[model samples]
Target: LESILANLSAGVLVFDRRFVLRTVNEGALTILADDFSGLLGEAPENWPRQLALGEAIRGAFAEHESSEWQEQIELEHTDGLPQILLLRGTQLPAGSHGGYVVVFDDVTRLIAAQRSAAWGEVARRLAHEIKNPLTPIQLSAERLQMKLADRVSGSDAEMLSRSTQTIIRQVEAMKRMVNDFSDYARLPAPELTAVDLNALISEVLGLYETSRATIALKLAAKLPPVCGDATQLRQIIHNLLRNAEDAQESVDSPSIEIRTRLADNLAEMIVTDHGPGFPPEIMARVLEPYVTTKARGTGLGLAIVKKIVDEHQGRIRINNRQPAGGGVVSIALPLASLPTRGHRVSQLPTEA
Candidate 1:
């Protein structure tokens, strides 16, 4: 019985009707980062203050009948970040000795994933609504200018031309923005194939050879292939390169470094650049759609990259490099040799 309770996935704790700790499983000790000996026979109010479970437990005992409640608790011991836990408390049946049982599970990652999916649905609906009218508006402006140019003369004709040009340009800009939203919202399943990472990176970089920025490549030899879609991978490379270029606009000398290597069971690709790093304020929410610092940016580039990476069952991290000044974007993908299912899977359209 003890061994079984020790291995349970969820943390379990039982307290007496008076709010004294009756029993705690090994799972609870591990989840709460506390010792079993310290919790036994102690009142909930006297439990370790750091755990912060005192108030919730006491309230449950105060109730006249069985009740249920849920809350999230953050623990600094796990890491420097908040770890979200889904806690459910149930009042045990009334009897000669009544108690309460509490169960909790770590659900931080699950909540984040759900939020991302919600954003993608929103992007798809927004694109559908905004993109439909842009083409007609642009064409109408073009036709109005061409047909009426000879009909009007002098300042009137000049004014008409400028107005139409502004309209066309603005409409074209809107089209680009809507297209980006569509891409983020409606990404198709990746067509999985064994792709040589080094070769793919070299090919993508070749497209920017004539640019003024200084670019460097450090391709590791004998690197393993990864399973992913070549087209989507190319887009990811392009977006990262373009972002690096834009980030360096305020700097005197711009340089970008693309590197590939094998790490443990994963194939890694890293893009680093000497430029103004991501602003501290938006760093946490960088992958969120429509969150941007650039004056003209649609802010969907990184979000789209994240969507594609998720489709491939890969991971990505972005952070400012230490000591030296710059930013790093690193991606880790499972090697092709690993046993994995094809990435081709459908996502049902989420309603707006």
Candidate 2:
């Protein structure tokens, strides 16, 4: 039984009727992402509130007559990423001395996959529906402006010109929004190859030398190459840098830091800004499409970045920096095993 519990991916915890934790499996420790030394043999009330496990155990103890209780709870981790856990609790059979058993599994990735797919479908439909009329709208406004150019005089003429120009400009903005939707919906698969991550970052940073934000780099001396498409990877860097700059818009001396390191056979890159961190309301769903805090932001930048990183089989984490108020975005990609011949870098147009 112990071997089976140890090997199972689902976490299991046993507690007596008094609600003191008695047995916890290896899976529980890993899923919780913390040390349980002081938690063992402790009552639920005494356990940390952040774990949220205590609530599940208490509920089970309160309703021992019920068949089972199940719930999904979000746990904030030390690393800043919140984990979604599916927990189930049940009362142990009366014959074996009354106790309760709580079981849980990490379902963060599964939920994220579902949300991404749903948003992608929405983006596809929006692109198809909204993009068709944009060109005609812009053209009609231009035609009206030209035809009325000679008919109206003085202030009336100015009014006509202004109205038409406003129409044209708004149409152009809508067109841009539709394009973003299309890009998010139909992002291409990354062409995997052995490419130096540090080199690519340096190349992207060159474009931002004159940016309003003071950019700094702490790239590792000899970071290994990662398997990714150069063009798509460049987009990731561009988007992050743009976001960092936007975050520090109100600061007297805006600053951005970019760092790279190798860990656990993965190439990790981190971008941080010295600005007010993500607002509390939207931090959890910041990666979701159209969830943005910027007044002029389409909110698709991070969503598209998430999609690209997903295509490369990479991982991303967003959190606010401690002590100093700012935001941190971390991305980790699997290191390429072998070097590629004739590595190619593709240049593609970037959005503002």
Candidate 3:
């Protein structure tokens, strides 16, 4: 069973008396971005995880009553990319050479999604609380200026009026930022239903698409109707597509692709483009609200998409389309179960 699972695309590692790998699965090798060729017949401590994994494993073993250790530890690869893994191990019985079992399940995407969602929440709450008093304050300042215009001397009136105007301008700026927060937080819960995902993509493409950027659709046929909120899902699709458009503005050939498919009892939505993909530096933080590559972007777009998908009890994924080319990202939603709402008579986003 372990051997079969190891052959799968999830990483697995085994350690022996000297902390050398006795076995490693294909998935683990892929994640390491290296085959076990040079790593085989080496001490577990000597393996790629020598410093971090070795110390963690040794500590867990010594501290445990039994030879089992289970934890979520973060490891940074030589590429400087971080891999979050849930590490689990168990000691074989006596005479088993004190060997241990280990597994590494990558949770980088999960953690990114969580961080994005959290920041979005914080921004939303801040905006909601600030908006209430802002409107009245601005109104009162304006009214005071109007009433005092004729009562005060010209010199004093001019200074007081300018001060009030400055206050009003600053308050408006603060309101706008709060509005961004409100937008991030106010995506109402999705009301999911059975609907044609391809149609949804087509409708959204025709609606919010920009003449400034080329939009491509390569939707799959023979797929099952997706179970999700048409309106909210469309919003998600709209936001992601717009984001792709914004990313492509920097490329000479800006093209966007939208695709749909079903896999492992889940429905999938993939958006690809012929532009620069996510920045290598901030890929880990891109989903977090206020984390944007654009000079003027609010950076809450992806964060909103993530929250909507999570509300539907589905999963989403983002990746650079292989071949080291342009931008390519994906979103996946599980459709094994039926949704709980009626068809939505809805609309899409305006042109960007």
Instruction: List the lowest-lDDT window of 10 residues for candidate 1.
Output: 343-352
- Per residue, candidate 3 scores C-alpha lDDT tens digits across 114-216 of 7766776687779878989999999999998999888998789999899889989999999988887887778776676776788888887787544577777
Q: Which has the greatest TM-score?
A: 2
The segments of candidate 3 whose C-alpha lies over 4 angstroms from its true place after superposition are: 1-41, 48-73, 76-81, 86-117, 151-162, 208-210, 335-352
**Number of the top-ranking candidate, with lDDT as the measure:** 2
What is the per-residue lDDT of model 2 for residues 74-127, given as tens digits with 9 covering 90 to 100?
A: 887656667898988888777788888889999988998999999999999999
Inter-residue clash pairs, candidate 2 = none
Residues 1-352 of candidate 1 have per-residue lDDT tens digits of 6777778988887777876788788777776666756668888767664445666556644653567877776454433234567777888777757778888887767876887989988888888999888889988999999999999999999999999999999988888877888888888888888889889999988889886679999988999788778899998899888889998998888999999999976789999999877776777568777888999888888988888888888898887776576878988886777534355222211210
Residue 304, candidate 3: Cα error in Å is 0.8
Clashes of each: 0, 0, 3
Question: Which candidate, 2 or 3, would have the higher lDDT against the true structure?
Answer: 2
Which of 1 and 2 is the better model by TM-score? 2
Per-candidate TM equals: 0.73, 0.83, 0.70
Give candidate 3's TM-score: 0.70
- What candidate 1 gets wrong by more than 4 Å, as runs, is 1-5, 13-66, 72-82, 91-100, 142-162, 210-216, 251-255, 274-277, 322-325, 339-352
lDDT of each: 0.79, 0.86, 0.74
Best-to-worst ranking by lDDT? 2, 1, 3
